[model samples]
Target: MPICPSCGAAVAGAVATCANCGHPTGPAVVPPPAIGEVVVDETAAPGPSPWGSGRIHQDRQWPTPSRGWLTAGRVLLAPTALLVVLATLGSTIAGRGGSGVDDDPAVRWTVHTFQMWLQLTLTAFGTPWRNSNSSSFGSSTSGIHVLPYAVAFGWLALLWLGQRLTARARAAAGAAEPTGPAAGAQALRTGALSAVAVLLLGWLSTGSSHVDEDSLSLSMQVTTGPAMLPLGLSGFLAAAAVVLAVDGQGALRAEAARRRWLGGWLLAWQHAARVVGALLVLLTLVSVVMQVLVDQPFPQSTFRALTVNGGVYLFGVGSGARAGVGGLRGGHEGTFALYDLGAHGGQWWLTVVPVLLAALALGWSAHRGRLTQLDRARLAVLYAVLTAALVLGTSIWLSESSTIKGQVHEARIELLGWSVTSVVVAAAAWAVFGALVVPAALDAVRRTPVPVSVPLPAQAADEPDGIVGTVELVAEERPLVGQVDVLDSHAAYRRPDAS
Candidate 1:
């Protein structure tokens, strides 16, 4: 039996990972070198392998279970704690505003409001809110899917903090962080665990109320239930996306060169991140400008407004309002309309210019050899699909209903949402044209041969120089190399034909 180098625990024969500490132990057997081949000892160096060296770069192991759990707890606790404090203050202020109810009722109202907010956060992450009612007349049920961008921001921030802490802890432990496949696996695991925990917590913290009055012969029950599957899936995805965004470094491009599928997926994710990030920055700026122009008095109000609008706009969608009473629905267009650059005359350039510039830049980089043609195509397709999905996911609807004397009245509204045909189609179209078509066109232009005129050997001073002949030279028709390099220099290079 060999002793685990990371934790000094006894290990059975040929195990890759230690059970106690979850650290990776190198392979048990070293194959003999082939004839005429020399082998260098990887352990000759005292530290981990340098990055981009085509080797696994780690000196220590993954975090111990205790550390991992502690970090995960903080990831959830910190954000929830902050939200709770804010909710308490806001609820207290609202309760004291001379609204008749002021004592225990006010306190109960505050707690109920906080619970509703928590449910909303879960709903934002894909949980569906269900309302059920039973009365002497009849029973009715309704559900809504609404995403409150403010809560989403907090959720993202929480995940980001968790990922950062994980990396920092690994560094502090003298461990080289995982990259490529390992990073993806770790992210998936972390996200799945966190999501499960959150769903359980939400279930436990669910708030419900029941009323029974014999005098009026009225009994009503209301419970807000968060669907398990949607919530878990959404939470897991959010966590995974956050982890990959934080820890991804070329996503092991060098290591996974032979695996074209994996390479393309990773490459797509990187580009998607870039496009989404750019769009978010643009939307945030627009929101800020609008806020300043509107001159909102309260800073808190401005911030809240920005978060709400920014969240919807970030996904390229529209919002609307709706109302209903006992199965009949009616409402007008929402106050916050979709920012469709396509529909806005003369301002269409706003959308085209940025995307075109980004595409051209990427095309130039690809032409210079940063990315191959196939990689670019993959990126375009994946990016478009991702954008469309994002738009769809951000669609939000909130419905609340109550029965008074057997008359059920309901108010439904779109917090942040979209229409599949318009928003989804527009987003996908933009991604395809801007991210794919533009770059490919640019590549073709750069590769085209250009004619250059040159003066044929200048006439000697002694000889007659009255008429100097000019020669037409056609530049070589080869692929244009990008001036900027985004890929690792040391990785194996393949020509276009070979690729």
Candidate 2:
């Protein structure tokens, strides 16, 4: 077996891995000679960059508000427009003539594609929950509903993008192998459970029959329909904003990092995601405005008597359909009060969070200030909490704004739900995220304790990157240990004694 340099273990000659230590034992595992092998693999070891440690670039700037707004505007623009336009098209052109993909082949195909995409967008059908809701919680969707699925789908996309950025940061630092594959597998496993739970919640949201608590038939329409585009858009916009915030670096330093194409892709995706985000925001805003300010009629039906696991469903005229697809008078009311409260509580108050984050994100660009893990975590926590709160509040409003028998417990539960959601959001932002960023930030700019001067590579002499990556890349050709020139002949022969 070949000697194992990594583990210093003995093994049979010809064996690849060391039998004792399982280290690489055969000839150095050379890269294939196809497309010029990348000789170095400086897995981000737990040490400083070649630059001396404790020396974060002394000159740093703050992220500003203008950039944040610009980013946010870009992110929300497309989705908003799409929702409004699609709803209008659906109303004027498609007409709600059929139910459950029972329409034209084109309609069926389109809906099917979107639905499948949503299903696979986030954690697969078997992933775990990221929230406090346990595996036993109830869901508010049912029978091929669209809003929740779409929102979930959009969120999945947004998160995937952001996570990719974080993943790159790890790779650049030569730290650890990316474990996103594992997390993805986990999410996929947990998703199935989440879907079932959420579906129950959906059924509750719709009230089994038409929401009949009020004369306004808005509840019935919501209960009977799908609101995929708007909700999906919300997730997309929010996710894009977050990814833009505290996570993009390789792109920011693309030229220096020698990744022009990748950098271009990042900027392009961000712009694309943001445009969609801004559009969605606008559409949602318009829909809300139409419902409350435009005085549109309740386009949905209303009913007061529908039982769900013994729970009742309320009716409403709230943002009647006349306003727009995403208008204000949510959908259901009464028995689904908890959901209503949770949903709207999230919506009405937290809109400012994203705006604030976007501002911070763009500000960073102008200031040339990268977020410390702590700073980024703080911001992420704040935004994530707000986002969740908005989701809960909006969901509640959609499900139970007009209750037939709104009770004290229901009100308490609603408020409690919101409060709990807010706190959890805050906590998650500060805790789990905080720990992760510390390592990542340090990996980016931390200096080495034993600083050694590095020579410049011929090609990279005037390049923006410092000596670190190049030095590590050349470490193998120039080994760290070498034999002394003048060893004594007597010492060389001393090993002959059978010690």
Best by TM-score: 1
Clashes of each: 2, 91
What TM-score number comes out for model 2?
0.23
* TM-score (C-alpha, index-matched) for candidate 1: 0.56
Best by lDDT: 1
Over 1-499, each residue of candidate 2 has an lDDT whose tens digit, in order, gives 2335554444455666767667765566332323433333244455433321212222334544342233333333443334334334433233233333445644543442332222322221122111111112222332221122233334355455544554454344343321233333323322323233334322322222333435633333223322333333434444444443323332244332354343333333343244234533543443444345533222221110001100101111111101013323322223222224443333422333433333334323211222333333334444344333333322222222222333211211121112333334443443233333433444445542211222335544664544322321211121222341122211111222312
Q: Per-residue lDDT tens digits of candidate 1, residues 1-499? A: 5656666666677888888789887863233335566445456467654332333433454544443344445566665565455445545544665334455653645667656555555665666777677767566667777555556666688778877886665445434445465566656666767687667757754777887888988887767667777777877888778776666543454333445566556655666666656655655565566466645421123224235444334335321111111231243243223343333334323434434444454444333333445565666676667656655654556676666677877776654444555654665566566555665676577663211221122432233322111111222132324431223221111121222
Q: What TM-scores do the predictions have?
A: 0.56, 0.23
Model 2 ranges off by over 4 Å:
1-177, 199-263, 297-499
Q: Give the Cα error of residue 95 in candidate 2, in Å.
A: 29
